[model samples]
Target: MSVALPRIDAIRDAAARIAPHAVVTPVMRNARLDALAGAQLFFKCENLQRGGAFKFRGACNAVWSLSDDEAARGVVTHSSGNHGNALAIAASTRGIPAHVVVPEGAVKAKLEAIEQAGAVLHRCAPNTPAREAAAAEVQRQTGADLVHPYADTRVMAGQGTLVLELLNQAGDLDIIVTPVGGGGLAAGCAIAAHALDSSIQMIAAEPEGADDAAQSLAQGSRIAGITANTICDGLRTLIGESNFEALQQHGTQVVTVSDDEVVAAMKTLWRELKLVIEPSSATVFAAVLKRPEQFAGKRVGLVLTGGNVDLEALPF
Candidate 1:
């Protein structure tokens, strides 16, 4: 069965529309990281973006592009954390109400970020079904358009713009690696990278506890029943049906890393690069470190997905 992928031109259009709201975050390249890892490393620091994650780019694009009539109904989403915050901020910018359904176990800091952006918070069970149910109820009550965190094509294309920016700024990447949860970012990466350079390897990295991306790739089917058991909370989602289609079609590389490895990479970034990256973002860095052979001597781009962390309370 052939699957339809989001159009690269639509993604490019989204990049243009969201240019102001979305930060054109820097591409930080290090000869040292390149030497140590045996590859030229260009890090797309979406970690430093507004709302502390790349979710802002998609949320901004989706929110702004909504018709005045459509936006009048407002927007709602089910997010563990970052997407909720991004949507809230985006809605706030458009002078529209945002209703966010988040899991009970979602980080308090993230919840506060959403609330701070003037969105009403609705809490739900931590599972997929429960989250869908809660979001459905919110949509029924608020008449809000459901802007999904990953599954929405607009959101995926918006996220795809990150790779476009990376390629424009850094250029000529042999491989592109990103952390995958619901696969929004990875699918976006694959579409953009492949469009930019058909032969460029697009890779997805996930924490072992949330390694469904890898399993789904290996099994040649969507893997259900994966538990969210990693410190990379942002990567705790199973790949969505559409995301799987993109990955399968693109033949994207999938890699898994341990929580310990994620932590080590996080520490390395903080210590070596002076960047405070989140666990999910570090998953990609860890993948590169763990499997240097795959990337050695190649020009690699690693999307550092976010930097949202509780600095006041960090795990030593």
Candidate 2:
């Protein structure tokens, strides 16, 4: 069966819905980075976003898209960290209850941030099944709308807004790279980038430890069973079916980089651009650095996905 994907109109509407609240995150360039990669790089600074990640765009859009009665009932979701915090903040902004099902041993800083944002937290085993069960329980108890991370149409539409803003701000760009975990950002980006400029290449960066997106694309179907063992905590999840379908239809190429490469790229961003970003965010640069010849002399846009790293826990 063919799945319905987020359209350009939906993305445009999402942009309008989120503009009042979401920051039009800046596009940055670094001479050192450009020289190192042999391409002119444009980094969309989403680390400076409201919840310190591009996740806020989708979370906020989902929260606001709900009807008055639905909002009154509240919202629920499962996340490793960033998405939960974003949804919590979004729910708080709309004055609704937010319930987040978080895996045990998730980054302490992120869990703390979710609580601070006024979301009721439920702890579960550090796996998909437990997280989903907890979220289902919350939804049953509260009759809240289930704002799935990357699976729902509204969240995908919300994420597309990032590339919409990036395309307009970065001028003509030959390539756009984004870290792919649940595939929301990658799928959303593919839609927006292709619609605006069909010639632009959309690339999905995945950690070698968690390369389901790459394997799925290769196998012509979604693949699960790979054990994730990377420092990129935000990117360890399996891609949702809807998101996988979107990637396939949009012709997004997936590339895998080593965890060491991800860490190196993270340090580079911090030193060269003076920007603090999480390991997941650095995957985009890791992909580019891994294949400089592919992007040589081109204007490449990289989405700096988040900056929610715990200061004490340096991967390097």
- Best-performing candidate as measured by lDDT: 2
Candidate 1 Cα deviation (angstroms), residue 222: 0.7
Q: Which candidate has the top score in TM-score?
A: 2
TM-score of model 2 vs. true structure: 0.98
Per-residue CA lDDT of model 2 for 248-310, tens digit only, reads: 888899989999999999988899999899999999999999998899999999999999988
Per-prediction TM-score: 0.97, 0.98
Give me the runs in candidate 2 sitting further than 4 Å from their true place.
1-3
Residue-wise C-alpha lDDT for candidate 1, range 1-316, written one tens digit per residue: 1234578887998999888777899999776777779988999999788899999988888898899999999999999999999999989889999999999888888888899999999988899999999999988988899889999877888899999989989878899998999988888778878887899988889899988878888888887768778998898888888898898889898888999999988888777778878899998889999998899889888998888888776766
Q: Model 2: number of clashes?
A: 0
The 0-to-1 C-alpha lDDT of every candidate, in the order given, reads 0.88, 0.92
Native-referenced Cα lDDT, model 1: 0.88
